[model samples]
Target chain A: MSWESFFQNLSNGISLGGLYALIAIGYSMVYGILRLINFAHGDIFMLGAYIAFYGMLIFSLPWWLSLIVSIILTAFIGILIDKGAYKPLRNAPRISALITAIGVSFFLENLGLVVFGGRPKGFYRPHIFDEIITIKGVRILSLTFYSLVITAIFLVLLFYIVYRTKTGLGMRAVSTDMETARLMGIDVDKIISITFAIGSGLAAVGGVLWAMKYPQINPLMGIFPGLKAFIAAVLGGIGSVGGALLGGFILGIAEIMLVAFMPQLSGYRDAFAFLILILILLVKPTGLLGVEVKEKA
Target chain B: MPFFKADHLVMRFGGLVAVNDFNLELQPGDLVGLIGPNGAGKTTVFNMITGVYRPTSGRIYFQDKDITGKRPDIITALGIARTFQNIRLFTDLSLIENVMVSYHVRLKSNIFEAVFKLPRYMRQENAMYEEAMELLHKVELDHLAEEKAGSLPYGEQRRLEIARALATHPKLLLLDEPAAGMNPNETLQLMDFIKQIRDEFDLTILLIEHDMKVVMGICERIWVLDYGKTIAVGTPSEIQNNPEVIKAYLGEEEYA
Candidate 1:
C-alpha cells in the first residue's frame, strides 16, 4: 500500500479509536466498580447520539450546546436506569444482576427502535466541520481533528478527577472493595451513582462525536461501536482507564489497516476482535493492565 | 451508661447457634478483649455488634442509641468501624488510598464536585490524603503509602487495616484477629501498636484475638466464650484463674 493511503488510514483509525476510547472508558469505569458488564451502556451511547441529533435539528442549538445537552440527558437516563433496574437487585446473586443487565440492554435497544424508527437518519454535520484540512500531504476532516482534541481533553479531565480528587478517592475505594469502602464511611451508593453518571456522560459524548463523523444516525448505530468499545475495554484491561484508550486505538487501527491492506479479509474484520478477545482471555484473563486480586467473598 | 452495649445477643446460622445470649459493655477509651477457642463465637460477637449480622434475640446500643439490625454502613456512620478476621484491604489500591477511602464518609464534597473536580473537592482531597498519610505514619507504615495494599508484608497489611479503620474516626473500633498468623515478634509489635493507637485515637476497642499473649498483654478487660456463650468476663487476672475459662481452654479431658 502507498504511504498516502497508509497515512489516510492512520488518521481515520485515530479518529475512530478516539471515539471507541471514549465509549470504552465508560464501560471500564462501570465494570471496575460494579464488576458487572453494563450491557445497556451501548444503548446509552445510542440514546446520546439521538439526543444530540434532536437538539441540533429541533431545538436549533449549536453543536457544542447540543453535545453538552446530550451528555447531561444521557447521564440522567443512566441514573434512572440504575435506580429503576439495578438498585433493587444490588444484593441479589451475581447471575441475577447479569441477567437483569441483559434485559435492560434489550429494553433500551427496542425502546430506541420504537422512538427513533428503523430508518437511518442522515446526521446533519455543522458547516464548520465540513471543511477538509491537508496535514503533511494527508487529507483529514475537521471533525477528525475535533474528535482527537475532545478525546484528549476528556481523558485528561477524567485522569485528574480520578487521581487528584476526593470523589475520585471514593470511586476508587468502591471499585476496590464495596464493603470495606462503606466501613471507611464512604457513601457507597452515592459514589456508585456518580460512577454510572460519569460513564454515561462519556458514552454520550462519544455517541455525538460518532454521529458527526459518520454523518449517519440510527437506533442501531450504537450497537457496533458499543460492542467494539466493550471489546476495547477488555483488550486494554477491563478496569484500567489508560488501558481502554490504548486498547481502543489498537483495535481501531488494526481493524482499519487489515481492511486496507488485505481486501479479501475485509469481511472478517468483526470476527477478528472476538477471536483476539478469546485468545487474550485464554492467555491473560486480566487483560493488558488489570491487576488480579482474590475475588471478594 | 457504657459507651457501647450488647445485651442478650444470639446469632444462629440455620440450625446452629453461633453466639448465644452474648453480652458485653464497653466504656469510652476502654480496650476490651473477646477470646475463645475455635468456633467459640468470639468473631460472631464482633460481627453482631458491628451490624454485619443481626442477633436473633437481642439489641445493641451505641452511646445509648439502639442500633440493632442497622446496616453495617449505617453502623459505621454511627461511629462504629471494624476490620475483618481475614484482612480485607483493597489489595490493589495504594496504602493511602485504602485509608482515604474510610475518610470518604467525612468528606463534605458531593458527586458534582468530585466529577467536576471543583476547588472544594481539591481541598477535601488534599486533606484526606494528608489524614491518610498521618494515620499510616502513626502505624509506622508511611513509607508504604504508595505501595499496593496487598503488596505490604502480612504484618504491615494488618497495621494498614487498623489505620484504614481509624480513618473513619470511629468511636468504637472492632478488630477481628489482628494478630492471627503473626510471628511472636510481630505479635509483640502489634500488641504495642494496638495500645498506642487505642490511646492515641482515644478509641474504645473490642478485639477478637486467638493469641492469648497479645490479648492478655493489652486488654484491660477480657471476656471468654465457649459453645456460643460467655463463660467469663473480668480483668485479665480474673479470666486467667476462672475455672470455666480453664475448662474451655484445656477441655474437660484435661480438666479431669
Candidate 2:
C-alpha cells in the first residue's frame, strides 16, 4: 500500500478507535460494577444516535445542545434500563441477569426498528465537523481530530472520576464489594445508577461521534460497533478502564489496517475481530490491564 | 442510656435457626467480646447488628435510634463500622484508598461537585486524604499505604480493615475474627493494637475472636453463645470460670 493511503487509513483508524474506546469505557465501567455484560449497552448507543438525530432535525436544536440533550436522555434511559430490568434481579442468579440483559438488548433493537424505521438515513452534520485539514501532505477530516481530542478529554475525565474523587471512591468501593461498600455507608443502588448514567452518557456521546464519521444512520447501527467495542472491553480486560481504551485502539487500528492492507480479507473483518476476542479471552481471561478483581470472599 | 443495644435478635435461614434470642447492651467506650464455637452464629449476630442481615425478630438500637433493619451504610453513617471475618478489604484498592472509601460516607459533595473537582470538593477530598493517611499511620501501615490491600501481609490486612473502619468515625466498631489465623505473637500484638485504637479513637469495640487470649486478655465484658443461644455474659474472669461456659465449650458429655 502507498504511504499516503496508509496514513489515510491510520487517521481513519484513530478516529474510529476513539469511538470504540469511549463506548468500551462504558462497557468496562458497568461491567466493572455489575459483573454483568450489559448486552443492551450497544442498544443505548443506537438510542443515543436517534436522540441526537431527533434533537437536530425535529427540534431544530444546535449541534452542541443536541449533543448534550442526547447524552442526558440516553443516560436516563440507561438508568431506566437498570431500574426496570436489572434491579429486580439483583438478588437473583448471575445467569438470570445476563439473560435479562440480552432481552433488553433485543427490546431496544426492535423498538428502534419500529420507531426509527428499518431504512437507513443520511446522518446530518454542521459544517464545522466536516471541514478538512491537511498536515504534512496527509489529508485528514476535522472530525478525526475532534474524535481524538474529545476521546482523550473523556479518558482523562474518566480516570479523574474513578481515582481522584469521593464519588469515585464509592464507585470503586462498590465495584470491589457491593455488600461491604453498603456497610461503609455507600448507597449501592445510587452508585449503581450513577455508574449506568455515566456509562450511557459516554455511550451517547460516542454514538454521536460514530454517526458523524459514518455519515449514515440506521436503527441497527449500534450492533456492529457495540459488539466490537464489547470485544475491545474484553481484550483490554473487561473491568479495567485503561484496558478498555487499549483494547479499543487496538481493535480499531487492526480493523482498519486489516481492510486497508488486504482487500479480499475485508469481508472477513467481523470474523477476524471475533477471532481476536476469542484468542485474548483464552490467553489472558483477565484482559491486558485487568488485575484479578475477584474479592477474597 | 446505653450507647448500643441488641434486643433479642434472631436469625433463621430456611429450617435452620442460625441465631436465637441474642441480646446485648453496651455503655459508651466499653470494650466487649462475643465468643462462640464454630457455627454458633456469632458472625450472624454481627451481620444483623451491622445491617448486613435483618433479624427475624427484635431490634438494634444505637444511641437511642432504632437502627435495626436499616441499610448497613445508614448504620455506618450513624456511627457504626465493622470489619469482616475473612478480611473484606477493597483488595484492588491501595491501603490508603481503602481507608479513603469509608470517608465517602462523610463527604458532602455530590457527583457533579466531585466530577468537577469544585473548590468545596477539593477541600473535603484533601481533608479525607490527610485523615486516611493519618489512619494508615495509626495502624503503622502508612509506609505501605500505596500498596494494594490484597498485597499486604495477613496481619496487616486486618490492620487495614481497622483503619478503614475508623475512617467512618464510628461510635461502635465491630470486628469479626480479627485474628483468626494469626500466630500467637501476631495475636498478642493485635490485642495491643485493638486496645490502642479503642482508646485512641475513643471507640466502643465489640470483637469476635477465636483467639481466647486476645478476647479474654482485653475485653472488659464478654458474652458467650453456643448452638445459637446465649450461654453467659459477664466479666472475662467470670466467663473463664463460669460452669455453663465450660459446658458450652466442652459440650454436655464432659459437663455431665
Give all candidates' CA lDDT scores. Answer: 0.86, 0.89
Index of the highest-DockQ prediction: 2
Per-prediction DockQ comes to: 0.62, 0.79
lDDT of 1 by residue, B4-60 (tens): 888899999999999999888888999999988899998778777777678899999
Colliding pairs, model 1 = A184-B102, A185-B105
What TM-score would chain B of candidate 2 score versus the native chain B? 0.95
| Candidate achieving the largest lDDT | 2
- Distance from true position, residue B189, model 2, in Å? 2.6
TM-score of each: 0.94, 0.96
lDDT of 1 by residue, A1-297 (tens): 778789999988898888889999988998888787888889999999999999999999999999999989999999899889998988787678779988998898888889989899988898878889887788888888888898889888888778877678778877888876776777788888888888899999999989888888888787889999999999999988888888899888888898999989999999988887888789988888877844544
Model 1 residue B14 CA deviation in Å: 2.0
